[model samples]
Target chain A: MAGYPQNPSGYNYGAPPPSQQYYSAPYGVAPPPYGQHQQLPYTHVASPYGAPSPSPSYGAPSSSPFAALLPSTFPPGTDPNVIACFQMADLDGSGAIDDNELQRSLSAYNQSFSIRTVRLLMYLFTNTNTRKIGPKEFTQVFYSLQNWRGNFEKFDRDRSGRIDASELREALLSLGFSVSPFVLDLLVLKFDKTGGMNKAIEYDHFIECCLIVKGLTEKFKEKDTTYSGYATFSYEAFMLTVLPLLIA
Target chain B: MAGYPQNPSGYNYGAPPPSQQYYSAPYGVAPPPYGQHQQLPYTHVASPYGAPSPSPSYGAPSSSPFAALLPSTFPPGTDPNVIACFQMADLDGSGAIDDNELQRSLSAYNQSFSIRTVRLLMYLFTNTNTRKIGPKEFTQVFYSLQNWRGNFEKFDRDRSGRIDASELREALLSLGFSVSPFVLDLLVLKFDKTGGMNKAIEYDHFIECCLIVKGLTEKFKEKDTTYSGYATFSYEAFMLTVLPLLIA
Candidate 1:
């Protein structure tokens, strides 16, 4: 409530403390501070004296002032290396990368993705304005990518450099996907091309699986064109209607 | 960048504009304003002028300013209805409800959940201090329930008061669960006791499935003790080890 004691009975309500209420207005814009000396992290220790080049690439030396202050990896601050990656990926020179462009570029780096998955990836990784991922959004992408890679490696418990079916399921589960064991098997079978049942999911396969599952769920819903809150599927009907999509 | 224009080359950067750089200290605390007249929505009309009773309950008239401001429903904002529910459910009067208490209360509302599922629900629904959920969290619970209910109704396309297999799949997908068809079928089969393949899932069953899928994923992960990213199970093994847990 507006006037209740901010803290009552040892509960810390979300409302700002009364002393700091003046500036904590809901949706109110706050000003910036420019008084502090710039601190460059090891990953962002590029020369600050160089002039901006005509075609600046990631990690390329540039004197954009902003480039010099980008932090390295850990804190995921504005790092020049990642900013350059974004700029390079913005192939249309629109100053913002749409989902398609980002996806294609990421695929080049072995992170293949379905469009919906890419959209989810965008939602998870970037802070977009009107779905347009600009430089600011790309900084978050760097951080998110670092996180995704870490998760991938950690879950690849066998150290096989690839996650097999069970591991992929765990990864999806941790990512908040409430997948079933049978579905997990189907996913691995669909994507895992190795001859034996021991087929595994590489990084690209893992990303693809995440997206395909999302896509298939929507596809399944579409079959319920009657809006009956229920749809009947016999064995023949499933083999005809759904099997191709999964294999495809 | 430390002092560059917030927007350059038509690209919006996250840095604050130079105009307000002095006041916008990074992570500076702001203050609140009390001068504005309260603009209560049609939903926030409260029955004021009532005195607080010794044992106040949700939606019950009370003199507490916060209670007076809580809304009945719709546009969920600090509604006393949910707060009262949380209070009524807080059996020990500890000023905070743990997962067990909340689960028991939710079960009374027909939203039964496993301990693991309840923990996930708590994570999704409340802001806790050392996992103790207080009134502030109950408000969030109201909001989350409202959201879940909305998602449920939306996917129950036929208005049949229940969701079928495909519909359930869509509902789960919308609920951020990338479920598989096989799993979807199993869920419906588990909940829809009225035999025949065209089983439907009511609200309670749907929530249970969401929790079950999550719980099962955790259980499956536990079986992968070797970190091999692969677990072996014969049909007999599955029947003995997994099916019973699911039915239970």
Candidate 2:
């Protein structure tokens, strides 16, 4: 479905103002009202895949500290802050950042993505022939991370900086996932930070979990074109399809 | 579904007997009968995802030229033929093969996969953190490719060495992908060898098409856990989810 551009301009790399630390909101505290942020241009466009309808806003800023630093050399529509981030991550002055650099950079920013997640990001954003991502892809990766961050915070309703099982269910629901309780439990077991005791998911693990679920479900749906829960696969097709996401 | 281990031993790098050129079967000719080949062990185990009963055999061989050459240093269960192929592809003697090497090696074998297909293969089989795939991953890739080759030949019903739209429909169905006519048309358009005029897909393109469809379907199914055929995505989530498979 069509979601509003959560953060059209880009993600803010600078720390949020003290009163607006939505990510670290204390337990039992509600996040700031969504209306407080500046509204983006309201024009809407359908995704090439024909996604439909706007969902609720996840808190996203319309501007960033690097907004005014756009260099003419980059592609148009490139996010300046993304370029800034990419440059910072390209520690070897090689004009590109590999997976190790990406992981270190995100961790530096307190994102702490797993090596797997960083690798997936690199696979998606870079030429698969190489491990490095250039500025153009870094822009897309940056914006996508910001979008996911907004969604994660929206679901961390208790403001404890993590989402418990029920919050995860609601979060997934908003994203159009109607997973069974069994599947939800599986997800919690897969991503839960407390090893199934608390059933709570921190941000990085949540992204990895969601990406895998979404990826696998999509593959199954291709075969289950009639909407049957059941789909068939040859041993090889099954292995080829599942192993990449599961083991990679 | 669980499938007969079509090629449990491994793919044969040596040419098949001249009389059994199944891949180049002329139009209107049937492939060799299924009973003519050596049978693998009849054991069956459910996939972790609980796939169902075995489908028909896909004409995989139970032995290969390199089977007797198993290296002492490799992991157990490692296929000798796959390791041999990996070493041949590792032009730099780096103990691994990168995407370019993979594409070149497949081409040398007359597989002629597209760069994009090679990228996806690398993404699925290798550590995403590096562009290189080690012997262990190469073994999986080799087996998976042989499996896909069997499936592709199975659906090339006319023995024309390529699949047409209707054949593709049947092929997808055999894999439990009951795609609609519109999607079938789209797939043909996406992979057609004659620029959509013939609506035919070569063997290499067929694998790529199936991989994309399978990957995307799996992703969508995660959100459509209720099997509703519809899923919602935040704008960023949508982009992140689809771009990797679509544009990578």
Best by lDDT: 2
lDDT tens digits, residue span B45-141, model 2? 1111111212222211213566436422345444567667878898999777877898899987556886668877675443242346766557656
* CA shift of B5, model 2, Å: 30
Worst 10 residues of 2 chain B by lDDT: B40-49
Which lDDT tens digits does candidate 1 get at residues B1-248? 22113223312212222231122111111211211233211101111101111122333333356754653322223456766787788899877788788778877754555554465556433322133566655654555556557867998888877888767755554443434455565566656746435578777666666545433443343444443323433222322233223212
lDDT, residue A216, candidate 1: 38
TM-score of each: 0.28, 0.40
Chain A: TM-score in each model: 0.45, 0.63
In order, the candidates keep a fraction of the true contacts of 0.00, 0.00
